[model samples]
Target: DAGVTQSPTHLIKTRGQHVTLRCSPISGHKSVSWYQQVLGQGPQFIFQYYEKEERGRGNFPDRFSARQFPNYSSELNVNALLLGDSALYLCASSFSERPPYFGPGTRLTVL
Candidate 1:
């Protein structure tokens, strides 16, 4: 099966702008996904969604939001972007509560 894939591998935006990152999980290994990552630190749990429902969220601000599609793909949307938002946004897929399979991250840079 194909591995998780993310779109717009690299992105650049300005402060106060909004951005969206997309991810497609591996086939047949759906039902759950979590997203988070930085350049230097370990992965941070941003959000978890299963069956198109949001199951968990991390300490991120309201400007950050995400949703899973019926196809099990997901999108992370960030509004009012800040330089602090510049980082590698990762997506992972898993079954039930199992550990996730991470995707190549989408790098976002806020100018």
Candidate 2:
């Protein structure tokens, strides 16, 4: 069974630009969540979608958004990004709302 996968292993951008990160959850899973991990800190949850509905959201700003599709794949969009947004964007999946298995993440770098 394939595990969670993320696109563009690395990314670079400038301030105020928009970015979208993609993810595919484990086969047969229905929950997809997004998290942001800075240089020296743990991941901070962003958004979670199950059965294509918004289930939960973290303390992230409106600039951070995500959605899950029928196939359990998901996308995370960050609008008007800031330098502080430069971090690893992780995608996680779970069979239920419990703990999730994570992806390697898309390393985002902003200048």
Candidate 3:
């Protein structure tokens, strides 16, 4: 199965640099979610956008933002990166009320 696909599987950025991560959901899926997973911790939800509208958001700073496109793909943007931002960025796709299918995720390192 094609499943979900994410770009730039690995990334390196200096503190204060901004980054944009991309995700393509499985076909027919209308809900996309973004999550951040730090070392030794479970994935923390960042945002969930469904049907091109913001559905939910987690406890993150304003520097984090995301959008879902008409095609159901999504992009997660983070500005003014901090060392603590180093983690794995995960993308999940699913039907509006079903369990999600997660992508391999993008690993980011902030120096």
Winning model by TM-score: 3
The candidate with the higher lDDT, 1 or 2, is 2
Tell me the lDDT of model 2 at 91. 96
| Residue 47, model 2, lDDT | 92
**Candidate 2 overall Cα lDDT vs. reference?**
0.93
- For model 2, what is the error of residue 81's alpha carbon versus the real structure, in angstroms, after optimal superposition? 0.9
Go through the candidates in order and give each one's C-alpha lDDT.
0.86, 0.93, 0.97
Instruction: Report how far residue 42 has shifted in candidate 2, in Å.
Output: 0.6
lDDT of 3 by residue, 58-99 (tens): 999999999999999999999999999999999999987999
Model 1 TM-score is 0.94
Provide the TM-score for each candidate, comma-separated. 0.94, 0.97, 0.98
Better of 2 and 3 by lDDT: 3
lDDT of 1 by residue, 1-111 (tens): 788898889999999999999999888766555556667888888998888999889999999999999899999999999989888999998877788899888989999
lDDT, residue 4, candidate 3: 96
Please count the clashing residue pairs in each candidate, in the order shown.
Answer: 0, 0, 0
lDDT of 2 by residue, 6-32 (tens): 998999999999999999999988999
